[model samples]
Target: MQVLNKVTVAVKGMVQTIKYPVVWKPSLYMFLSLALSISTHEGQFYWYTNKEPPNPGFSQEFVGMVHAVGAVASMVGVLIYHKNLKDYPFRSILFFAQLLHGASGLLDLTFVLRWNLALGVPDAVFVTLEECVSRVVGRVRLMPMMVLSTKLCPPGAEGTFFALLMCIDSLGMLVAKTGGAFVLRALHVTRTDFSNLWLAVLLRNLLRLSALGAIFLVPTADQTDVLLPQDLLSSGSPAAAAGDEEERLLQLGKLTSHTDDDV
Candidate 1:
């Protein structure tokens, strides 16, 4: 019963989160689009590389090397975000990341066209470089998402609300995977054959680009301090706690009921 109550409260908080103009709207739309693009790209990567003309399959060693390089690149991305991007608005960081990642999807098309092979570059090297760069940017991009999700949790119900937000993210991943399978089936892409892989890459890139349209849903400033439970608890005055409780009530009321502005 206690677990059920927590789940209920968590769900209620999630509903409230959807009505939060600065958090939920952008997260919902952009997150889904990005997830779909990521899922499409990931689910198709093996087939994309294996279907290369003149070379039917990627060597396991070469794929391992590329993955090793990408792992290192991801670590570098974390350092870069900490040093260079920590001060930027979360929305701006996420926007640029999404755009850059979308542009990188075009690299898949270039691979399909065998553009680098024409320039005397080995397929292994080209794939390694592309994977490295993509991993770096992808890691940087995901940082803001976790931060924003944490920031959206309301006072007193922080644990419940944060868990609900994370569940939404996980749900997006599941949907993305399902959507990618549907696209593959729809396009008839399979391991031994990849006739329509170029179309798949294009569609994934377009979906990534489409996520940019939700930028307005991001808050312009760091607003996490607005309703911190700790702030209320640490006020050192009974009146302050009472006032905060009233404010929290009003805020939650606004969240549950449909106001014209909320709509």
Candidate 2:
């Protein structure tokens, strides 16, 4: 009964969130990005599991190397973006990440086509490099969204609103897994039979690229005030309401600054 009640409250909260245009737009962009990337994410696992000779399943050592590279790249990306790209338009950065992510997916296709071998690149070297760059860009893509989620929450309901946004993020992953499974089965891509694997990867990359269409939904961090609803305006004097809003923004910034420090 307790769990049921909690679930009901969560459902109500989510419904309320969707009614807010500002929240829904960014949420949609995040969902689309996650859904589109599922193909590439699952494709990597399939590659490691079903690869053919000379580049068959990733050895334990290779997996460790990729992990190390990803960790280092993640740290570097976080630092650089925090210092440099933090203020850049969120949508623009996301679009750039989408392009880089597509390029990374293309690297998967290269392995599928054995282009790396044809080009005389060792499998380990190429895969490691691809993982490093792709993971870095992926980290960069997420930081802005995290910061945006924090800032987008209205006063006094931060926890519920942010959790709902994260739920959308999780929903994207769920959809991606479902979509990837469907595509893989449709393509007959089994653990051992990977003949149509390249096509599957191509499809994934295309979906990722197509997600760029939703980029416009993410507003710039600086544009938040401009996008606020007119309902927030004062009932009487415009000057007084504008002044009150400015004070609210100032308080919000202080709150965000403290939150950043905690992070």
Q: Write the per-residue lDDT of candidate 2 for residues 195-247, one digit (tens) a residue.
A: 78889889988998998998889886562344434442224222233334555
In lDDT terms, how accurate is model 2? Answer: 0.74
Candidate 1 local distance difference test against the native = 0.69
| lDDT for 32 (candidate 1) | 72
Residue range 1-263, candidate 1, lDDT tens digits: 54464455555545654565655665685467556664665445665456456532776676777789899999998998888887788667878988998998777777766787887887777887788888988888887777777776655556766676787788877877777788877888777667787787788788878878876766666523342334333552233334355568767877778575677
In model 1, what lDDT does residue 72 have? Answer: 97
In candidate 1, the residue pairs with backbone N, CA or C atoms under 3 Å apart (3 or more residues apart, or in different chains) clash, namely none
* lDDT of candidates 1 onward, in order: 0.69, 0.74
Cα displacement (Å) at residue 237, model 1: 19
State how far residue 32 of model 1 sits from its true place (Å): 2.7
